[model samples]
Each structure stands twice: as C-alpha cells, then as structure tokens.
Target: MINYICNKWKAIKRAKNILKNKNKIPPYLKKNSFEEELNYKLWSTKGARFSASHRNHTLNKLSSKSIGYLSAYLIIIGIVNLYDINLLGIKILNNQVGFISTAFSVLILLFSQLESSENFSLKSERYHNCSLDIAELYTRARFIKNFTINPITKQSELLQISIDYDAILKKYENHLPIDYLQFQLTKPEYFGLNFIKIKWIWLKYYIKVYAIYHILIFGPLLTLFYIAYLK
Candidate 1:
C-alpha cells in the first residue's frame, strides 16, 4: 500500500550526494536528516556473532564525571609541576621528588587528552540512528512513486520495493563509528608527541624518578669531584 515517490534511483542519488561532499545534504532534504536515522538502524540491525565484531558493536558512553576527574588530576599535577619548575628550578628540584612527578604527570595528562578526543557512545548513537533514518526515508519516498512500468520487465515498480538493508548491514558491519573510536584509541602511534610514539609515556615517569634518584645519590659525590677538579 505504501508507494514511494523517491524510489531506488532517487535513494541511490541521495547517497551519492552525501558521499561526494560528506557535509550537509541538499536543502530540500535537509530538514529531515537521513544520516541520524540511518545510524540508528545500523546499530539495531543484528549481524555476525564473532568476538571481534561483537566487541566492536557494543555501546559505550564516557561519563562527564570521568572527564571531571581527569581534569582535576591534571590541574593538581600541573600545579605541582609549576611549583617545582618555577620555585625550585629543574636543577634544584632534582633534590626533591617534584621534578620527576611533574614530568610523569604531564605525560599522563597529554595521553588522557588523546584518549578522550572521541566519544564512543555518542558516535555509535549517530551511526545507529542514521541507518534507520535512511530506511524510513526510503519507505516514505515509495509513497510518492508516480512512475509505472510493465509487469514482466518493470523499469518502474511501486514505491514499496524492498531495500537490501541486510546488505547495508553486512557492508558496514565493522566500520561503525564506535569501531573508529576504538581504532583511534588503540592506535596511539598515529597521534603525535615523542613519548606516546615511543611507548614511553608510562615509562617516562619512572625514567624521571630514576634520574631524580641518581641526582640524590650522586649529588654529593659530584660536588666533591667538582671541587677536586678545580684544585
């Protein structure tokens, strides 16, 4: 009973338009955005039960509370770092534990920033909604179908023609927005900064500590050697 005005050809054209620009769709269709609904359908539609795919599809949201916690931690650590770096100076602060702690803390903060760049649940929600939206649009577009064709070789059928949603599911199964976020999180090397690339973000903290430890153990010896050399 539901025939669409915008049938297969029109839908395909719309998709092409979106793919071409990756921005806002044309003005006429802008009011009811297809992307949001399409994402919903994508998430709701079930797919393979493989561990990797299953894991990838799971919805996860980052709480604002978690952001607050990280922010507070960074602030506290930064204050300590500034206190040592400014008041004590790195050389004098070597005698204290502040220098090492500051370095470790800053590295951790930067790494945390990289991790929080993308929100998982938010992106997944968009992808899931967009899929369903497109399907609904297609269904509606059928209602407006005004073309006619022969039964045997129908070039233009009723708007109720079925879409291969299952095919869409299969194609985008693993490339969901959440999957992109997961990829971003796991691929730290793709990001910048020397420590993260070298896998030393965590170890750098200990390196700082070791340097401080050496400074403490050898400070006196170095001072003596300096005086002896001067003599």
Candidate 2:
C-alpha cells in the first residue's frame, strides 16, 4: 500500500512535464515501472488544461455580448442627440426627458451585467479547483488500494504507497498547489482599469451633459411658464 502511494506521487510530479511537451504522453503506467507512472501524470495534466481553457473561452464570449449591447446604446444616444429638437422649445421637453430616463436605465443595466458576469466567472474558477482536489484524492486512493493487495511485488511497494499517499494528501490539505484556473479568472488589469476607465469617463460625461441639458431646457422654461401664468 505504501509503495503504491509513493508511485502515484511520483507519477503526478512527472505529469507536470507533459504541459511543456508538444507530444505529451500518459506515463506508460505499469506496476513498479516508470512507464505506468508517466501515463497517469499525462492524463491528469491534460484534463486540467482542457477544463481551464474551455471555461475561459465561455467567459470571454459572455463579456463580448455585454460590450455589444453597450455599444448599441451609445450609438442610439448619438443619433437622438443629433436632431435639432431644442429649437422647437417647450414642446420637445417631454421627449428630452424620456431620452434622459432611458440613458439612466442603460447605465444601471451595464453596471449590473458586469457585476453578474464577473461573479459567474469567479464561481467557475472555484468549481474547477474543487474538481482538481477530487481528482487528486481519487488518484491517491487508487494507489493505496492497488499496491496493498496485489501479490505482484515486494514489501517496498507497500512502504512506497504509504509515503506517496501521505505526501499527496498532505499536499492537498495544505493547498500548496497553485491553481492556474484561479489566476485565469482574475480580471485583467487592462480590462478593469483601462477599458472600464474609458467607459466610465464617457458615462460620467453623459451624465454631466444631461444634467446641464435639464437646467438649460427645463429650468428656464418653467420659469417663463410661471411668469406667463402656466406653472
């Protein structure tokens, strides 16, 4: 049992090499042999990589959709503002108010969507980590069971399995392994800082301009109406 556990630990250590190799192979695992250990390592590494990449791609697609909707909103606002509605005066006040209201709604929607998407991405990373922990546990258990009962080898195998399983379990318990999935999920500084910074600058500008528009168009109009007795 102990010898088998040691073998599994060695197998996992060796599997990390597969990531760099273009032609990664499962360490051809055979009892008490190097080949068998390598095959196990290879499969585990590949599975992790595939899972991470797939999740990241899905997140990218979702973010792109949000960006698309935001772009359309800006375009519509641009078109509406181009019309010479102001020259018509008080009659256009109601429509101008409606446009401002719509812009506020879109701003709120954008903030909510970004928050939700980021939360979902973080959850996916957590799920990936849990899956990895389970896989390591299963691998260690398999090694302990295989080497314990098999009559194929010497007492060394039992000792090796014990050491390997202990090492693997300790490694997992300590959370010593760095999860690339988590790293990938962390939002890029460029996206959060640069992209969002630009978006928000424009949004702030829009809000400022709209505030001015209200003061310019409505404040004086109401004053004039009151003077003329239309309050």
Candidate 3:
C-alpha cells in the first residue's frame, strides 16, 4: 500500500500530460481504448462548461458587490464629511470632497456600463445550460459504457455522441484554461492534485475572480492604516 501511494504521487506529478499522451499512466486510471475519445470529449467539455458557468455567475454577483462596495465607500465619505470624523476624506483624500465624489461617481458609472456590456448573468446561464447538455451526453455514455457489452455497437453510438459534442461546443464559448484548472481541482481522483497545487489553484481562482475588488476594497484600508497608525 505504501509503494502504491508513492507511485500514485509520482504519476500525479506528470498529470499535466495525462490526456494529451499515454505516458506514465497510474494504476487508478481505467482507460477503455474503445471509448477513449468519446469519454475524453464528454468529460473534458463538461468540466470546462461547468467551471465557466460558475465563474460567470460569480462574476455577475461580484459586479453587484463591486458597485455596492464603491457606493458604500462614497456614502461613508459623505457621511464622514457631514461630521468632523473624516479620516479618509481629510487625511487620505486631502478633503477634496467634490473631486473625490465626482471621481467615485464616474468610476461607478463606468463600471456599471461595463457590467451591462459584459452581461455575465446571461453568459452564466448559457454556460450552465451548455454544461448540462454535455453532462447528459457524458452520463449517457457512462451508461452505455457499463451496460453495453458489444464493442461494435458501443463504438458506433459513442461516435455519434462525439460528433454531437463538437456541434454543441461550436454553439457556445469555450471555457478558459483557468476554468479547466478549477475543474481538475474538484476531481481529485482523476487529477490527483496535491495540497500545494490545490492551494495554488485556489489562489489563482481568487485572483481571477476578486483581485480587482480586493484591491479596491483593501487598498484604501491599507492606506488608512499606514497614515493613522503605522506612520
């Protein structure tokens, strides 16, 4: 068992070339030469579509959050200006209330326009539905794989499904590489992602999704801390 685990770890290190070629295949992989192409298509596309679907949905949600945070910052600045406790407005912003408000307003406007143009909500729904269609084909293929004993008939049916897979992909946007990386993280048995790789992927996902917002939200706070205490 120890030896088995070690070999799995070693094989997992070469995971980048898992489906691209038949190199150091681990013991756990059950590759059916008959259904290899079909299986690979359905699985890979499904993962990509699902990952992209979630990513877009999160982006739509984040758009609202971006606006909300910026708006809140503006509101706080206004409220602070109404009183004498305007640390951000006084120290950080140099009490330029009019300019600050105008700049924030413009930023908000531009971002809202961008959010509308991107239409992440609609895109999220599209990828979600697309993923479902591909998942249906994948599940059907799995059923055939298990129950169908005749190699010839299975191959013929899977071939048709493979053709349909290409058509479906053509109808929708292909997911980014980052999306596929996220999917691989979700399937440990298949990808064998270790702790470091998983953390790296998680960091990449956060950066991809929320880096802008984090900078927007935290940048001011960090500056405030420096001026208020660290300085």
Ranking by TM-score: 3, 2, 1
Tens digit of per-residue lDDT, candidate 1, span 59-81: 22223333344455446545655
Which regions of candidate 1 are displaced past 4 Å? Answer: 1-67, 77-105, 116-122, 134-231
Which digits, one per residue and each the tens of the lDDT, describe model 3 over residues 1-231? Answer: 999999998898777566566644633245656476677767877888888999999988888888888899888778766764757344534357767878989999998998889889988999999999999899989999899999789888888888888899899987888998998887866677889999999999999988987787677668667777754
User: Local distance difference test, per candidate?
Assistant: 0.43, 0.48, 0.82
TM-scores of the candidates in the order shown: 0.28, 0.31, 0.79
Which window of 10 residues has the lowest lDDT sum in candidate 3? 23-32
Clashes of each: 33, 24, 0
- Sorted by lDDT (best first), the order is 3, 2, 1
Identify the leading candidate in terms of TM-score.
3
Q: Write the per-residue lDDT of candidate 2 for residues 63-106, one digit (tens) a residue.
A: 55554555554454445566634322433355764775577567
TM-score (C-alpha) between model 2 and the true structure: 0.31
Candidate with best lDDT = 3
* Candidate 3 displacement at residue 26 in angstroms: 8.6
Q: Which ranges in model 3 have alpha carbons more than 4 Å from their true place?
A: 1-34, 88-95
Go through the candidates in order and give the C-alpha RMSD of each one to the true structure. Answer: 18.0, 18.6, 7.9
